[model samples]
Target: MSASNRPAGSGRLLTGVAWATLLLGLWLWGRGITDGSGASSAPTTGDIAAVGRPHGVLLPAAHAPIKGTAPERIEIPSIGVRAPVVARGLDKAGGIDPPPFAKSQTVGWYGSGTRPGAAGAALLVGHVDTETKPAVFYGLSAARPGAKVRVVRTDGSVAEFTIDDVQVFTRKRFDARKAYGPRKDGRAELRLITCGGTFDRASHEYNANVVVSAYLTGEKPSAGKSA
Candidate 1:
């Protein structure tokens, strides 16, 4: 989702580093990030227009209750971030839903895709700014290519990903197909998202959205044995 599509709120927006850590932490908290269920009451004309477009396969239909557990800790040596995380789902309105962050608490997952290590683009989105204050993901614009991101899952598994690129696009120009399209090799990926660009008081949202693309390197085995 684009920044303009996000819900209005306020606070210090989290930087890219913080957002990554927050997602990892949410995984540790037992909040399943891949539980994609609950269909909207009715599809709008716009939704109908999007049908048959190659934006990627729709997630499965199954909404499991969120367990109130913190995600495992995450450490990104490249960005110098090590913190806890949480998970959350999108609100009734369609947007890049975010979780609450305070007292060292990170936001939760958007819960709209397969698990992080699954064979698809596991989406994790957060807020960039609210009405009164900057929200988490404010610093998302600072990320650069070749950066490293590390996530620890609740199953005592560690996944490492490398930042391939960062792109910023206007709300109108945003392409879900290219942004969330299926990978050629059928590998797992991470798409970290947040709002960006000039904030509009009238709209109470940023003009653009910042997206960071990362490809999974490999998973660490539970046992000492290397995979």
Candidate 2:
């Protein structure tokens, strides 16, 4: 889901224009795989339920305070991404708000969902392209299985994950069951999401969303120690 590959859609979710706005704003502000270790673990039924419980819901305003700062950093040498992560919540519309896009800044986490490095599947969503310009996650589609993803948390801890799979789903066909679905093992997982698919000229947005799934390989400061 690199900025160049961002898809189109209507004024739904994060508007393409808004995405562009976010990217442009960031640029003005400062600016800034491979080899598999066997079948990656899958989400357990309970894990899936936890994520789906809040499907399409916006994060409470109270959580907005955590929107900035690097709870972690994600890197995929194969795709050339090594951005710090922040926390982001949904706007009044129940869709994720744009994440910070400045070069030195970290990407945002969905303040509404489980934090990355948590026990369950931590979810993060960003814009592939806000407008015609490339935004954070613009190159997400290039990532492949076996790529490495690193997360550095606020607690001075870091967790490493390996890319398990990359999937795309139409907005209408988006199966929340699968998007936030649980793994059978309850292993910690991460899901990075962005808009993708065909761009609808009339709608000015992408027809679908792109999703990247990864699993924790190992981490410093221990896996579930509130990092």
Which ranges in model 2 have alpha carbons more than 4 Å from their true place?
A: 1-13, 16-70, 100-106, 222-227
In terms of TM-score, how similar is model 2 to the real structure?
0.63
Each prediction's TM-score versus the true structure:
0.60, 0.63
lDDT tens readout by residue for model 2, 33-85:
11112221222211121122223433211101121224666666776777767
Model 2, residue 203: what's the lDDT?
Answer: 57
Residue 24 in candidate 1, Cα distance off native in Å: 24
lDDT of 2: 0.53
Counting clashing residue pairs in each candidate, in order, gives 27, 35
How many Å off is the CA of 21 in candidate 1? 24
Task: Give the distance in Å from residue 200's predicted Cα in candidate 2 to where it truly belongs.
Answer: 2.3
